[model samples]
Target: MSTTVTQQPQHSTLGEYKRWLRVSLYTILLLTGQCTATLLGRFYFAKGGKSKWIATSVQSAGFPILIPLLFYSSKSTNHDFSKPKRSVMITFYLGFGLLMIAMDFLYSCGLSYLSLSTFALVCATQLAFNGVATYFLNSQKFTALILNSIVVLTMSVILIALNTESEDSTDLPKEKRLIGLFCALAASATFALQHSLLQFYFEKVAKTGVFSVLLRLNFYPMIIASVGAVVGLVGSGDWRSMGMEMKEFEYGNLELTITPILAVFVFHDKIYAVKIVAFFLAIWGFLSYIYQHYLDDQMANQDRSDDGLQVLKGEEQI
Candidate 1:
């Protein structure tokens, strides 16, 4: 008698390894996309004279797409919009959006003088600012570990900023460096305040379906920014001038790199090796945060499972 060996259907350890590998690989790609978008935004702003028009036009085109995405995500998550919390939710969204627009505009104004790398390094102080702000806001308790992390994060930012400036000629005036420092500090404050406000909204009002909350929050500021752009054009008597300028300006089709990257290569930064290292450091820091969050979630799930097992054993004993 010939016996047939039956193969059990199961995911091998290699399969699990591949699943994690894919997740990590996708995370890096997502980070790359975020970093590229951030770099390109500064590049466009730095290009000055007419690139503002390009930024404004691109933002306008992208705004409409978010609305459909918002609705779809909300539906997928089974979010109830008619829950009678509309008034509070709308207020929170508007407040958050307005705050973001104000902060962003201020940062943009400051960027006319600061280098992209300088701004990125300076922005690294956000963790410190957030910790201090959270303490004052009474939104979260700050532990010694949190305090130490903030101090270290702040020191690293200061060192990075100083190093960048020192590499510039010593003969360079003090006022410019001072202005950069001040702008960076102010930017950090704005960033921290925005975070505090957002945390409050997320915890209190818009708890379900974060994507829907993001959609509602984004919609108002987007409208405000569009209006601001139009007013800026008309106020400067450059509405006609902008149109004429757009004719000569070449906005490239959506590609791997936006128009700004090409502009940076051609007209602005050379993208040094050191800056590449800093960029990687920033990306690593962000990924570390995501990893920590995943760990916390897993712990919570394990606790819930243990609680359920204890309850089952008690019921079986009875």
Candidate 2:
């Protein structure tokens, strides 16, 4: 009887279980943060918030929380730091940090005008952007399936734009909407490119995938981003109005009242035929990618198992 290696539990070891737990916990945190952050940002705008810079800075300011994780990962072994000089490392981290700040600003700009649904659907194209970046940066070959995914996802975005009638309840001017659209797409592209660059550099140059290295890559850049945001916040003088903005925030009882309000609010997203079509089309595109990922994982596992069998058979014969 052949041993089906694929049938093995992924988290068979204690270490594997811990890793899986960490991953699941982080995934949940990320999802919660993404949803609440966007909801609050848009809520600010819907309630007459005029300070985009403040909103942008808020995103960067959260980097401090990563500090503990950096310390927690300090003991992780097998990390490969880039061999470049200190200056080079500093420059690399600073550059990416600035890119992140720019992305945050762009996202704030989008939230200023676009409806949450419209902005989110447009931003969802980042996965397709990552696919393109992987092809170019990681030397990943673009098969017909990848091309189809890119196309279908692109069409989904277009349909979202066509569903313009009920995009944002705020009803900002058309020029404002156009600006928001551009900013949203640009933010998505920047996000995809930033992560792609990090992944490519670490895997190719650093040549390690340890948790410590990954943690360092995250926290270091965040420090730079936070500092940069502070400078922007001070220079733009938006901080002057920050106190007033906070005091006057329409959702003064945000923690107490906003959760249930948004749950019902977003659920009532005005749906048009175009939006329905786009929604399903996006699901189709995402599902296709998921299935392809499963196949790749299976193939990789099978190849490893075959090599293991060959080694065992050779040892037995000897």
Candidate 3:
């Protein structure tokens, strides 16, 4: 008689869970970093800080800081980071980098000319533009939920825009206000397009660890954006403006350092009901808008059918 031996597949449920936990933690940290960076950039521009190029370059600093984290994570997972790295095309990166630089410059200009509140309201339009860009770039289908979300979000932004217009009792000059409005719209569109392009690259081009992918996505663009900023800084003679920005850097930099810890706490506490509700409401509003459009289309079709029947009956009578 002969005996046979079989090997069972190894299960690593705990290992998988640990990986998930790490990814979640890192995601929270990144989000917090993004919030802080945005707030700091906005605050700096709001206070008459004229070094838009420097501000843009500072925001790109987050990318390099994450490189080591990504490398370690990849190593822990036994990923072959040494493999020939697949990346987005150079042409795409160059074009995307230019767009990012333009968007940042426009956003800085808008912040300089407009109040923070107004600029924020205008920035919300990016969500709507994102939908359109995703549809075109990523072949994202417009399901009812997505359509609803877009509609509601757009309506909310429009209401905010109207409110800002009504409350235009500010000391800002008309020319500045108009320029700010144009810059805000342009910035929103460019940002949405850039985001869409990034989504495409991540989905199609990148073949690396998550950290590596993110680092690559941000690092090269940061270099390009830094170059643009340096050119602008020299061209505008705003190199001296850095001193003023640094003097008031406490306003935003401190928040950047603190927010990551606060974000961790918020993630652990689960005290986010209000934000959840608001998010759902936006989705609900979008759904209703899409449903309404659907109904209107149906009604128009019915009216055309009725007209056709009447025309047929008149022809029979004649």
Candidate 4:
């Protein structure tokens, strides 16, 4: 009877392993799709035309699509928005949004100096930044795994920086290009902080679906971004000239416009070896995260089951 019981548990464990595997695979595909879309958008932005507007335009215009997803997720999760710690949520958004603005503004200049592939690699430093920021903000002690990830990521960053060659034939100072990398690092830091803040909110305050939380989080920032975009256009004195005659700029979202521009002006071709490697690295990192999360969850479940079994056994013995 004990052997049969053990076999049943083994079968159950196998089932969970399979389920987690499937989820991990699905998550990888989702990440890849999103990455592809973002890469295409970046390409358009590099094309040096009205396509630059695509970034802000898509951000604002995509609110409608986001809304439905948010609503459905909130319903599915049974998340009570009203029960959230309002003060904490407010502070989080305020701090995160300001950092995002600063990062974006800083990169607005750096983008002029760096190549798309270079920038993409620079952005990947966020994983390391998140670890550092979490230590400072949450006072979380790092485990060996986290420390190792940071070390590996740091090495990758070094490799990428060393590998970068100036393709721009313009008379821009070499020092300015070097400075662009630091700016990109600063942007990555801000992104990491923002993510850490959101993770804190979801775990510590009120557990909610990512879709709902993201929608709510984006609401104020989107307004700020829209205002900033409008102001930038006016301040540049190119308000009248920008995106007016270009048939490509007619779309509600700028990312779509940016895609073609990037393809034509910046990257100028299909996938390259380095980019393919980067993509795989990103996917691997993402899978590692999912696996770690699943392991934690399994341990928690095992602890609960053990506790329950102990109590039942105690009653039987009594």
Q: How close is candidate 3 to the true structure, as a TM-score?
A: 0.62
By lDDT rank, best first, the candidates go: 2, 3, 4, 1
TM-score of 2: 0.85
lDDT tens readout by residue for model 1, 265-297? 553444555555555555554444445446655
**lDDT tens per residue, model 2, 121-164:** 78777878878888888887676666777788899887766555
Clashing residue pairs in candidate 4 (N, C-alpha, C atoms within 3 angstroms)? 43-262, 44-258, 44-262, 54-254, 58-254
Candidate 3 regions with alpha-carbon error over 4 angstroms: 1-31, 70-88, 164-170, 207-210, 240-318
Model 2 residue 126 CA deviation in Å: 0.7
Name the best candidate (by TM-score): 2
lDDT of 3 by residue, 77-187 (tens): 545544333343566667777887898888877766665555655666676677789889999666665576667666655454344333332356767777877788799
TM-score of each model, paired residue for residue? 0.67, 0.85, 0.62, 0.69
Colliding pairs, model 2 = none
Which predicted model would earn the best lDDT? 2
- Name the 10 consecutive residues with the lowest summed lDDT in model 3: 1-10
Residue 219 error, candidate 3, Å:
1.3
lDDT of 4 by residue, 112-148 (tens): 4566666666677777788788877767667665666
